[model samples]
Target: MRLGPVLHREGAFGGAGKRLGLGWDVAGTVDATGVATAWGVGDEVVALDHGMVKPLGTHAEYVVVDAGAVAVAPRATAAAHAAHAATLPLNGLTAAQALDLLDLAPGASLLVTGAAGAVGGYAVQLAAHRGLAVTALARAGDAELVRSLGARHLVTDLAEVPGGAVSGGGVDAVLDAAVLGEPALAWVRDGGAYAGVVPQSGPDPVRGIRVAAVEVAADGARLAELVRLVDEGVLTLRVAETYALDDAAKAHARLAAGGVRGRLVLVPGAGS
Candidate 1:
């Protein structure tokens, strides 16, 4: 979900008198609102900003979003997997922001903590696409999957490379998408950068490295680029399962259980 400082009252999960849809991702067609010049009526889109529309709705047939918070979704796979597109915005944008913060040179090395998770998965792919060598910290079983995503190296346990043993001194930067907190900062080289998804934990700088927490903002242009990656088969979205909108409680339970490969989606017209 969209998060600001705990002291900040406006957030996706806070400052709420009423809450509508709880998800941070959504994919659907624009209603009859032809006023949105970038998105016309009936245009399929994936809405971001943690799905916090003004009136607060996404699990229903209609959702209101800022004009800049949506990207045109590709039609090739939308028919079969519209729900999958719903998983892109929050995690995908977070990943994109993490990479942008790093800004490493081409052929540089990167370490992505929690590389098997949603945001980390995209980070790995995008890092690879940027010509950076990626070392993915994932479970043993995800080795092949991460390898396919362009990670040149894999470490099953973070402890194995406490101080960047995987790449001699350390990687050029780290994208800590799994919220590994300060502990993951050890993987970066001196003068390198670390971008964490959760800032509340407050990572200390190590060995002259720069550290920053990523806050995903709505950018329709960037989202459109990500969508194009999916359209071209450069990035892949995984869906753990789908539930009817009414079964959202059950979906939350499944998420809490953990070990989910991708995302859990709720469809409006589907049955429980």
Candidate 2:
């Protein structure tokens, strides 16, 4: 598919040495390649192939990708699907794989930091759907929203979780989306685990607690399932704002200003 709108994330890997046009999340239309049979002509798809410090052209008008990297979104209108496809790949997969690292049993308890953000928000919902009792730590304003997403315990701050000397003593696992670093380790039980998105900044293991740094990989099958959930209303994606490609810097600025609940999308040209 030719690239159209791409998603912008702050503090993403490869940001220090790079500028725009290096984003991994993208929503675009199928091109005229003979390989369009699976995706079809005029199909709206989300193609994820951008990598850290790698060749990334999704910010431009076109990006060459294999069929395995893209997923067609038929359930949503153009604008809505742009928002969904722009987000479904990276954050959704991160949340899914992060929870997989926890390997929690049914009825297990989980604490998700930054529960109002994109990855954390989806983690809250997906974990809850998997029968894990989720405790969401986010701003007070997002309490009701997180609760509706299936977070049982709502705390405005991570400090609300009492620190314990050992693992398996506090919550069962911690999905550290807020980048709490070592401080989040105290919230996990003696045998529990801590899953962080950033590997280099992940906490050191202690008290028999496992530390896992989640690495997101593109799985078209997984993306398709996530899209189905979105279409079925089981999963809801939020778009904080949409900007034309030329105004991508503005989207980055808005994301940097903080308190964004969803993603910032960059349309290739003039956007609605």
Candidate 3:
């Protein structure tokens, strides 16, 4: 189980007395298989349950996921494991799909807000790997972190972005991972693109800029590629903390308190 921003929001303000399950990412060994499925019992796997409202979530010890949504887990390395792999499905896919939406070519200038956050960090790494000129907007303290993630430029303040980075005097596109909305949109050149993480809630298009929010979908093939990247060291994973699955409430509280640098994972049968 993994803690995500959406899970925090849902537990905090998703209304009371509802029995909705609250998780999207899961990594574990397959305990069973259905007829005609390619997966077998005992396959180490990772999957995204992919829904805002569901009767059951991936937070549990056992979860039911579509065969198409599951991928072979990353081979454990000295620095990573199922906990790290758990952080990949939702956040990694969101970044990859958002980049797909932006559709920028190599050498195009791009800005990513919240560059230190989970999705934003992945966006920085993936965008740089694709050869985009990435300017990351994150806290002053995170300059080194974002830089290590492959950001070509780092800005503590949005106003620090240089106008000459692009031919149009603004970034060719903006991946608004911080959800700065209109403020972030202002940094995009006319006729450029903007991609937000929230589905259908992005700012309206202006200055001929194309604006769209990513609604991350489950893609096992794409997820497998990401897992391979992790193994190849093309991608990095960080786990901020771990908790026993029963301590979910405490985990949620920590998430609400903010300042988490990496993902908080819930380990089944873990101690305190």
Of 1 and 3, the candidate ranking higher by lDDT: 3
Best lDDT goes to which candidate? 3
Q: Write one digit per residue (lDDT tens) for candidate 2, span 104-184.
A: 988988999989888888999899988998989888899898998889989876668744434346898999988787877
Clashing pairs in 3: none
Pairs with backbone N, CA or C atoms under 3 Å apart (clashes), candidate 2: 167-189, 167-190, 168-189, 168-190, 169-189
What's the lDDT for all of these models?
0.77, 0.76, 0.85
Count of residue pairs whose backbone atoms collide, per candidate: 0, 5, 0
- lDDT per residue, candidate 1, 143-237, as tens digits? 99899888998998777664554333777888987667666777677788888886444488867888888768888889999999998988888
Off by over 4 Å in 3: 1-18, 77-80, 164-167
Among all windows of ten consecutive residues in candidate 2, which has the lowest summed lDDT? Answer: 1-10
| Candidate 1 Cα outliers beyond 4 Å, as residue runs | 1-21, 34-36, 50-57, 162-168, 199-201
Question: Which pairs clash in model 1?
Answer: none
